[model samples]
Target chain A: MARVVVDVMPKPEILDPQGKAVLGALPRLGFSGVTDVRQGKRFELEIEGELTDDVVEQVRQMAETLLSNPVIEDFEVHVEEHSVAEVAASEGR
Target chain B: MARVVVDVMPKPEILDPQGKAVLGALPRLGFSGVTDVRQGKRFELEIEGELTDDVVEQVRQMAETLLSNPVIEDFEVHVEEHSVAEVAASEGR
Candidate 1:
């Protein structure tokens, strides 16, 4: 199986109450120093077989048409061998 | 400012209708080959200053306490200098 991850975020112009709530709760929980927080959506799709360019395109279409609200949100389609943390660690990002 | 991303996914046993809906809509939209879809949450936090290990720890705590529902979800905290798509592309993931 192939794993393709899609990350979706609200448009910058949009207001996100859920993010705001998290930001507000930080100090109360004794975790400070955060200036802002924006919440989004993540989708993991397990394709039945090998991941080809055509399948990637189809997944992108799926993200744009059904997974995210184009008017107020944006999304990214990622195909990786591992999870996000490992990627970050590998690149030291 | 430091930009860190947090990715949270529902536990495997959890039912995700939103994801299922996306899967169901794919073929109707003429985009097939997807076997399963799982949805989660992504958070982008803009810290006020540098991203130190301590700051990372605080952010992790924030994620664990407020950003994600631990009982039914799992999360990854990534300290990065760019967006998720850029990261994925940089690593060719």
Candidate 2:
């Protein structure tokens, strides 16, 4: 099965409290040098077939309509035939 | 500032309703070829200095303690000196 990955992030203009909270908590936890943080979402779709344009377009529509809020977020889609686990294993080689 | 990216995903054994909802909605929206979906989170940290090992380790700790739940999710950290926008622009070249 092909793996299609969708990455969604709040628009740069939007305030991200979760990210700010993490950033604020970092120094308190003894981790320093972090100046900013932005939180986002990622979706992994396992498809039964090839990584075709039709499939990619379909996934894009999904992102626009359901996976993300277009007014406040922007997203990107990545298509791969290998699962992320397999990709990580190969990278370890 | 350097950009640190943390990618967090649900354990393979866990259920992902958001992803399932999207997967289910695809065919209803006239999009096909998708079989499954898994959703996750991504964090982008802007650091004030270099992408050193110390910073990477701190970010990893943050991921373990705050960005994700170790019980149900796994996370990966990526350190880049260039911001994502810069990287995307360069890739557009």
Clashes of each: 0, 0
Worst 10 residues of 2 chain A by lDDT: A84-93
lDDT of each candidate versus the true structure: 0.80, 0.77
TM-score of 2: 0.85
lDDT string, candidate 2, B1-93, tens digits: 778888888877788888787778878787777778888898989888667787788888898888889788777777645543444345451
Q: After superposition, which runs of candidate 2 have C-alpha atoms over 4 Å from their true positions?
A: A80-93, B80-93
- RMSD of candidates 1 onward, in order: 5.0, 3.4
lDDT of 1 by residue, A7-56 (tens): 88877778989999888988888887888888989989888888888888
DockQ of all candidate complexes: 0.45, 0.51
Chain A vs. true chain A, TM-score per model, equals: 0.86, 0.85
